[model samples]
Target: MKNYILFFAAIWMTVCFCSCDDGRIYEQKVDIARGGRTLKLTGRFSGLSNWADGYSVVVAGFNDKSEYAVITKSLPVNVADGSEIVMTLGGIGDEVTALKLCVVNRLRECVVDFHTIESEELAAVTDTIMINAGTLDVGMYSTIQSQVFDKKCTMCHGETGSASGNLFLTAGKSYDAMVNQPAHKNSDILLVKPGKAEESFLHLVLNRDGDTNMHHLDLFSEKEQLSLKLIDDWINDGAFLNNK
Candidate 1:
């Protein structure tokens, strides 16, 4: 019985050791098989240093949640000068079918710019892809700007002096001025809340619900109504400033 127990223990220990050692080798083999290459990103000449001290380029799997997961990040790239910046992504897995790019502020951890690229599109690219400055294709904030604020709200709240209720709905300034900020009339209600659109004063006024009796008759128009829905959707989708 003692010999039998000793033999089984020896077998178990050997199996454990082999399995642990093999796992690493298996992973390394897979990585080699998957292969990798460097991807270059070129962007327009914009003084990024005006916004943040430094920036990082992040890549992640092609999913809404994975977009912010930061699978890999580049070290700080020079953003101080208006000269063109080229960011190189090394060891990008061949299996990365679809991916998103996130340019983040190193200090605040906020994404200043974002974009999505498909594998097919990447394959077709011979040269570095040009990045749009301060734009995100899938972000809720950009949708709101193009659909809602630019179409309707800008009439009253566009430029600084023209903005009514001390609110500015210009492209770059709108997010900061409204997000988590108090309403002009009602200090208790926020103009836009990150995840709670129903609680937002903007939703209340547009829908003519709650204590706010003021409703824009223009909202009854089909275009304006669609804009209102887009705004509501934007708020529901975490009210993200840069990327979805």
Candidate 2:
């Protein structure tokens, strides 16, 4: 009986060593998209351990060269058993090719684990579950902006900004070009009102339709739509007048 008891204890320790907080492993992901030239990003994380406090969450993606790499920062999800974190990519510098999520123990050895990500999966994460507060720390921003600029805007305008004919969508230049352009001051007509994304040119292009049913694709999902609201609020909030 003593030998059997010792054997069971040994097995328990082995299992604990290999597993995360819950003695089980899970996968999570992040999603990113654009608002015209601005590299806007938001994503919901799933697969939370029953005890998820202080777990370091990182969103990683591929650079232009198609190499897997970290986005230069770590996103922190505070709370034990915490399964989700909503992040925004602020002031990102370049484009992205692929995405993934890294979950660190934040305990034990403080080691990290990774999972590949996809646009659709990310959309699903946000769609099915809410990302609590929906804000991004600077570390989280790296992944957010990278994904948004690369996945959404890069194909069209090259990076977040840098569009043709004096158009730049890069997050850094997005707000500026839109406000300064005299010829196209109201060209798209999306930034005038806050909280009302429907009136914005971004929606027109994104939804691929207008009062005339222009017949286009509504690329964003329901969750993405909510993210748009957050963005519009920021813009309507005087576009962070500190910059204006």
Candidate 3:
């Protein structure tokens, strides 16, 4: 009986040692899975415009086929000019094809991408990834010109010799043609009245309920609500040619 008791005690100790070792291994894995895989972003925003209620800037992960973000974290918009910003996105799964610093609408759709980390680059990361984006300019008017006017409106307005409503939305000419300029349809209303979106004819014509013969609302899809809001905010913020 004494011999049997000693043998059993030795086996118990061995079992306890193995159990503790396994527990430590499991905890380490859990910790890694929870917080080890991360992407850190550091940069300063230069020409940021006023962000509206439904629109925001964020660091997000996405796949190739979808516009909707898989994971996202909102960036601070109230920071002073040239303030160094640091943001991190943790627990990034293998399914993420790309990571982007971009403007997103309320539906989490990426409106415009300011910076991108491609899948090939992301795959190289075994652990934490650090990226310095340098300085990004996120002014609303430039974004509006590039994304909306140049792409959508210039064909009818500036690209053709016969500009619609005598408005030219092409680059180098759009700012002067719109801001504080009188609308051809209504001489009394300004195309973009500084500090007042409600009084701006450009804002009014973009909306569905606005009294206009032309269905300008059709030009912008459901995906462009953020763009529309940006225009309104730009007008409300004095419609400057340069926010810097």
Candidate 4:
């Protein structure tokens, strides 16, 4: 009789366990107002060059009316060039029916193809997404070296020897020599003030808008000549070390 009772009790417990197990299989959804949960991201960086400074993985929300994605936030990623980057990104609002992830250059310019995930797609993934940020452009610094200085002014400012104006248009030294440092000719003016474009002597020299009537070089409208506004944009953008 006792054996029969023990067998019945064991059967009852098994049934209860089976009932609770059914609740565990369900979808995980984000609360619309609470800004959703963070997702783990693993990705590879490719084709990074000396000019490729820093990078960021940005997440954007979708606009229903426009059927477009606009970047809402960015996850700053700091990793060595050409290495796999592993990080987590948040700010995924529940209302975000679609998500766009992109790798951007230091200037926040998109360098790689963007990945888009719909709400239905995101729900299907159990955990972790692997993304690859492929080859970025050589970027502004490289552009300046190859086109601006190399073609126009490297005769006076190159790394082969001591450059005139104490500026070296070498592969790696030009950015530092220009940013935040005062111009060789004028102490009151900066060569390339990081956040101050108009005040930079380089801009004044190129556009001939400085206190000194001395003109360095005028930018020609020829297709080959870089626009003078590029100098202004570079300086106004917080002239980052290593083009950060």
Candidate 5:
């Protein structure tokens, strides 16, 4: 009986030791595979109301060549203004060249990049990376001006030579020129009638079926739905210059 008891105790000790050793080995392997990489973001968003439909704000990782995101996490939209935002992107892969805080359209294409972490910065991260993006005001009208009018319309509208239709889309002049003002092409309709997108001539010219010159609709292609929505929502929301 004494011999039997000693044999069983020895076997139990061996099993326990093996289990502990295996656990340590597994943990080490996992750590090596993961490289202890992580990204932590802390910030607050202002002008939350400016976010339009069919678009989402996201924290995304991307490669240098593609506009499409490699990995993305949607941000909370229902939260009140100035609410603390805490997010983490862990186990980042080597192929991911950059990380950005931006708005993406329904197709997952980045519409605008608000903040970015370049590849060099990402490569230097040893363990946990921390980013404190101070208050961001993501207003829609500003986005429309930069992404739409600035890129697509400035040439004919106001950037150089005579302003076509006597309208200036240049900054500090566009708002007063469009809001509550009559369209030069057609004096019967307002350029942008606050609280009504369909009634606004600006929205009319952008719509494919709207009552305007076909050339106006061709200026912005169908792929630019995000830009169209921004303009539409801004008008629907009273077309305010500052939506705080």
Candidate 6:
């Protein structure tokens, strides 16, 4: 009897949580009046990056005439927890008897819907968002080195920095070889360009997309250029040792 009871309880719990609103319990509610109707339609949700950053809004009544639909798609600015956002129905002046907001995240794998009660008292939402100030004061080149070492170069490059061809990336000698190395780039390829710096082999190495036997840094590319800027800034700023 006890075993059966436990089994049933588990099933009940699963059914309850398999809903959009409950998927990411991180929900928020914002009270607002829409279209001269004192109703709440949606609440912003926060604390996510692995989810889709877009969603769709829907409103309907008994007849198709009262039905309304719209899509909400926007790029999100990352915050401490996730991205900050505002939720709303896309249409106005439509006789909205019932409203639903469905969200699609970054991966577009998870889809959830929120609903409003009446035409007027529609929005009873949950808004959850975390705001992060956008700032990259860190040096650009060093950041590149850090990324190359931490994410890209480190794997095969090795801690000793001499894993392949004995080129040597070991901390003490890694920077030197990278700065003005000729053998690193192929004959037809000039990875790093000195003086100008931007046209260097390092740039080609990180941004390489052709048949260069090297595994590209697709995952690391988003911030790699910015990191280069930081590195360039550091060199111009006296190349001070920021041994972070």
lDDT of 6 by residue, 13-122 (tens): 88887875664553422222233222223223332222211322222222134222322333342433332344333333344344333332233221223332444344
Q: Alpha carbon lDDT of residue 48, candidate 5?
A: 54
- Taking the tens digit of each residue's C-alpha lDDT, what string does model 1 give over 1-244? 9999999999999999999999999998677455564556665433232221243445443323332333455524354434555566655554555555554334323242256777787666543444434322323465457555776678888754578778898888898988999999899999998779899988888887546877564455752354465567667767777532
| lDDT for model 5 | 0.79
Worst 10 residues of 6 by lDDT: 55-64
Off by over 4 Å in 3: 1-33, 40-45, 49-56, 62-70, 73-88, 94-98, 105-111, 115-136, 160-162
| TM-score of candidate 5 against the unseen true structure | 0.62
Distance from true position, residue 154, model 1, in Å?
0.8
What order do you get sorting by lDDT, best first? 3, 5, 1, 4, 2, 6
TM value for model 1: 0.42
Top candidate by TM-score? 3
Between candidates 2 and 3, name the one with more favorable TM-score. Answer: 3
Each candidate structure's TM-score, on Cα atoms with residue i matched to residue i, is: 0.42, 0.33, 0.63, 0.43, 0.62, 0.32
Q: Any runs in candidate 6 off by more than 4 Å, and if so which?
A: 1-148, 160-162, 185-191, 211-213, 219-225, 231-244
Task: For residue 197, give model 5's deviation from the true position in Å.
Answer: 1.6
lDDT tens per residue, model 2, 1-244: 9999999999999887877644333332222222111122344433232122343455544445533353533554343223444454432323543354443333212122244544444434422222233432223223223444344555555453346435565655555554323324345464334344456554444454554353434545553453343334433443332312
lDDT of 5 by residue, 1-244 (tens): 9999999999999999999999999998788577546778889886555665666778888887787887887777677778888988776778888888878877678777778889899898766668787887666776677667888888888899568889899876899999999999899999999999999988888885447874676676565666677688778877888653
Clash pairs, candidate 1, are: none
In model 2, state the lDDT of residue 146. 41
Give the alpha carbon lDDT tens digit for every residue of 75-136 in model 3: 78678878999988897888888888887878888887777889899899977888787986
Cα error, candidate 6, residue 35 (Å): 36
Clashing pairs in 4: none
Quote model 6's TM-score.
0.32
